[model samples]
Target: PVPVFKSELTGLTLPANAEIIAEGFIDPNELMDEGPFGEYTGYYSGNKGKDYPKPILRVERILHRNNPTMWSTTVGKPINDIHMIQSLNRTATLWHDLETMRVPGIEGVYIPAEACGRFWAVVSVRQKYPGHSNQVGNAVIASTTGHYGVKGVIVVDHDIAADDWDRVWWALSTRFDPKRSAQIIDRGRSTPLDPGLPIEAREITSRIILDACTPFEWTNKPNEIFMNREVLQKVSDRWNDYGFDGASPVANMIDRLVKPEAIKTKKK
Candidate 1:
């Protein structure tokens, strides 16, 4: 027979096992080696060999449906299904935070897959103020959702796609100056999965704010570049009819004039 206990939060008595004895009390000061359990980071570290204090989770009661099925997840590489879900969550949360800031020329937000969904974020915003990119970077780090796992937050001009690594690198190479474009934060609670931290101590992580915006020193730049969508649509409609097969004639002509080889290959 199973005994039941009433929960303070749920206000219900839950069926609990009496004989399958595991006993522990919540001690704010006490710490023990809790797990060598498999973690989402795809590494196992716990009370086995390492001398690290583990926070205790007190289990008050247990409930079971007759013959319940246990479900579990494994985390490792970037392409994992769990990582994809986290990436989507990060994108939505980051986008919402940026929109709340009302930054000018804001285009889109994306957290790339390679960054493990939480360690890094890229934001695309219009450069309105002298240090707009830096402002965005700081705001991203300060955001409640952003505060968790992010070690770097990069802000780029609207011209750069937040999701495209190549374009992001190009912007960094051309627009960023190490002295002017970088901001470093010395201390924050680090992600536990980050192997850089020593197993015995709480990890402190540094955040890098990369301002990938164009130089504000250029006064002749327009505040906004408007695209004539109607004209663009017309060009797209007539692209195949024009001598440019499966390509935009205007784009092809521009490429041909600037660098002829760029237009030689058809886009797959």
Candidate 2:
């Protein structure tokens, strides 16, 4: 039971923190098509088909704060406010939903803003078995956040960071074998605003789960070379002595990490 606020103009009862109050409801017996708006996909979707009789809201009156700074943003482009807002919100939802579902080995989840947080989601896992990745993927696919719109999910070993697209691609290329690692489901709920969907079939979609990890079945796998922690810490402590204006290894690590062949991995 959430607290409610009664709007003076429309007499609409809304959640206490709701910024705006409107009198709107839909009768399942009635339907109307709406949209063709600039969707978050960075394209115009849902505008091509016939107008379905979707729910229409009749705003009797509107009420807001005295000096409310209306938060708004444009779609059809990545790295904008819309994507940023969706990324934070959708990522939180995905994380929480995964936790609520009790999915094992759930290390991290990241829904990148550049994709509008709908098309692609990345999950990091400490896989316990060969099907652990699939289990995690299935749980995510069935979760509330993943039950709709998300077309692709990539599950990577816990060593990889979900937000690091560069490493995600690296894992995909090195760890994923198309014939063996791909999982496809024929049908699922689709994003209404997906331009890639046939105008008539935008309501349903298929999903792809790419298991971007070295299969647990293998006994011997190539070891990933990483910077020595002790050396890294020593370098961090002596960062000022190396004549850098800032006492951080970011400037030193960025290029070296990107171009690993440029530097020799220190051996014990």
Candidate 3:
């Protein structure tokens, strides 16, 4: 909270321990040019689209404490200032909003810190009926928080971990169909910081809903092959006997069986 105005001689009122103060009056009708600010998108956010004037604050008084410690921050880069500062609050808000939305099949919600916690999101859903994933995608787009700034929303199956990029990417590759599984919106609220759009178009951005889930209409899912538990257990029980060091039996078993190229391929 800012200091309140108290006495003319004292300027803005300060707490007993306070040492510095500055006073400003904002006339709502007064307008000024602002920005050319370095934004969280790692690009300069300049005046874009229609030039909207900014409010002007006129400083009338200044006071100082004996010594002051200034607090400031820098931005740009994913999971950095932009991500760290806003991710928690914004994700909480999104999760709350989605909860209230009551969209069917919704199991979990996440906003990727890689998008400064605003631009991209993922929703995990346990598909209960045909078109359930699409319902989630459209509902999220029209929901309160999703109506603004969010450029992309990916709906994944409940088995996929929304917060894990590896799982998300795997689902995206195997489940997403360029011809059928995407919802493309022509426009939605955007900001000047978006670098992918033209300056004039930054006021609104194209939204995409990428559905990374199997079609719920299917009668049966492809049976996935798995390693035998007995074999895995024997390997784990003998891991130390085989001289594998620094890793537990469970870790050794995983390393023995799972390889980057050996993941289940997408069903035809």
Candidate 4:
């Protein structure tokens, strides 16, 4: 658990280990025009024609630890620390939301930092009934973490890890039919920082959900091919005998396990 302290000025509890803390209040009626600063989208936010109106925080007092270290992050485009942070936080938040909503058979959830962390998500689900994959896809868009900013979702089978791009592409190629598995919704809450939408119409956005799992209701499902376990083990065990420079790739195939039912709720 994180240590906490009560602020003497605002009577609010805060993290005791923080490097710096400011006791402040924002007046509801007060507004100020803020910037066109560079955003995580790799483009400048706000407009030259219309300065964005934002509430200003009036600092009453500031507190800091001795020899405080100021932490900062760079946010721009994809694959940055900010994007990575956003992906991690969003993925965990989405998973938590799904667990709280009792959405079963979820194997994994991943929001790639390459998609700016807010636009696309991939989910792997174990389909237990007809239309189960579709239900999970829709649930992702409706979740608290996904209802805002997310534009696309890809749902795959349990055999595919959400973060494994190779398997994700393979599933899309072999199992998906655009006409049968794609869903397009026209209305969802949007973030103003989304450059895809017009500045004046940034409050609403469209979403697309692509289901890549095979239909659970089908009577004749395609058989999945797999290598013989005994043969694979033998080959891996004798890898060095073949004058290989490194260990067999099969030696590193420890499966990742995530139990949705065991997820704990985050404290406020």
Candidate 5:
């Protein structure tokens, strides 16, 4: 369904979906089910087949060019184009929010595409303070989208790429201890589209925070042992000379799996 834009004060309604807009606040009490419309969670949320209240967007005024395109995004599964946009947004917003909280040694953040831009986040930060990984995980749980479908939040050291699940998993395998490094919060509030929620209320769900960062208490040895960056870079620069391709080994593996011929052979 299309949304009709109208001015409450002037009673001026747009000819159609006009491009220009003005913003104003409205009473929450005045809200109706604005949607069972398509939501980013790949579901028709709100009162469609079920009784639910949707948030209302009250228009205060109207202004626009002769012809303007309305910015709209499709909501569906992970591969949908809009999911890509949301992924970028989640990464930026979560990164900024954690940085603002003064969590030290944050190198990068990535919200995986498979999580539909909301369900999971992977953070790469330098391990400094003991229990710092848990602190970062809790902060993420309190963030906007992070409070939603986020079933898991994995924290890794700066050496691992936040976007790479394999590396993240490796970090978890080597660094995380199930007893001391993982936390589960029951009855947490998550987005309504989360399939894990047994009730319709947005305030009820559960989540796990995994501290994949290396244990700081292991002071008997160095936390990380790796080639120096300058040396690594020099090796990387001449990698081709050593008969190795510069392309990612992971990407090459994915290519083999997704190749059309491979699919046909598997089907046969």
Candidate 6:
């Protein structure tokens, strides 16, 4: 269980084991000029290095534990701690929101840290019927976690993981038909810090949703090529016969794609 205590300054419950707490109040009338700080987008967001007026916070009391430690991280560029946190948080939130909305057939969701976490999202869905792929794509944009900041969404088949970039690209190349798959929304809530839009028009932006799943309505669907499961098992069983390092090569994705009866085993 977690420990807690009441703050003398505000009579509010606080974490007793906290390193430090600075009680403060934001005065709406008191404004201060704040500068262009580095943002998660790897660029300065506050008026391109110019100071902007912001509400002022006044600290009235302070509390701390022994050897209190203060933690901080720089928010800039991709593959950083901030980007990773954004990815995990946004991904989980998107999945949760979709689940709460009772959107069916959602398999996976991923917010890539390389896309600044907020700009792009990839989703995997098992299409259930005609227009199911479109439903999922629109649902992503309407989700609580995805309604803001996200500029693009790529919806793929359940066979691919949302985080698998290679398979995602493959699906985009093979399954995506621009005329049918592309959806462009001209109006969206934009973040004020977004550099793509002019400072004056930062309140609105565009969004695009790309559906990469094969149409569920098609009766004569294209047969996907897959390796024979029997052959794969034979190779795994005879790994020692071949000169290779470590255990048999892991092919989790391939294994999932291939069914024993789907393709015939090649004659040895």
Question: How does each model score on lDDT?
Answer: 0.71, 0.79, 0.77, 0.87, 0.73, 0.85
In model 6, the Cα lDDT at residue 264 comes to 38
On lDDT, the stronger of 3 and 5 is 3
lDDT of 5 by residue, 168-198 (tens): 8887888888998889988766666665454
Residue-level lDDT of model 6, residues 137-253, one tens digit each, is: 788889998889889999999888899999899999999999999999888887877888887667888999999999999899888877767677777777777877677764444
Q: Which candidate number maximizes lDDT? A: 4
Candidate 4 yields a Cα-based lDDT of 0.87
Q: Cα miss at 241, model 2 (Å)? A: 10
Using Cα atoms with residue i matched to residue i, what is each candidate's TM-score against the true structure? 0.64, 0.75, 0.79, 0.79, 0.66, 0.83
The runs of at least 3 residues in candidate 2 whose Cα sits more than 4 Å from the true structure, single-residue gaps closed, are: 1-33, 55-68, 229-268
What RMSD does each model have against the real structure?
Answer: 8.5, 5.6, 6.0, 6.7, 10.6, 4.2
Flag regions of model 5 displaced more than 4 Å: 1-35, 46-50, 54-70, 199-202, 220-268
1-268 per-residue lDDT for model 1 (tens digits) = 6678765655656566433423334777867766666544556654433455666757665545666666545567666766677788889988888788675666878877667677889999877767777778888888876887788987888766788787789778877889988989988768666655666653678889988888666777544334444466577678887777666656533432332233355332
Relative to the unseen true structure, what is the C-alpha lDDT of residue 182 in candidate 2, on a scale of 0 to 100?
93
10 residues in a row with least lDDT, candidate 1: 252-261
- Considering summed lDDT, which 10 consecutive residues are worst modelled in model 6? 259-268
Sorted on lDDT, best first, the list reads 4, 6, 2, 3, 5, 1
Residue 50 C-alpha lDDT in model 1: 47
Better of 2 and 3 by lDDT: 2
The candidate with the higher TM-score, 1 or 2, is 2
User: Which residue pairs collide in model 4, if any?
Assistant: none
Query: Residues 5-108, candidate 2, lDDT per residue (tens digit)?
Result: 77665566778765655565545666556666787888875564344556566555665666655767777778788898888988899999999998888888
Scored by TM-score, the top model is: 6
Clashes of 5: 0
Candidate 3's C-alpha runs over 4 A off are: 1-20, 27-30, 60-69, 228-245, 248-268
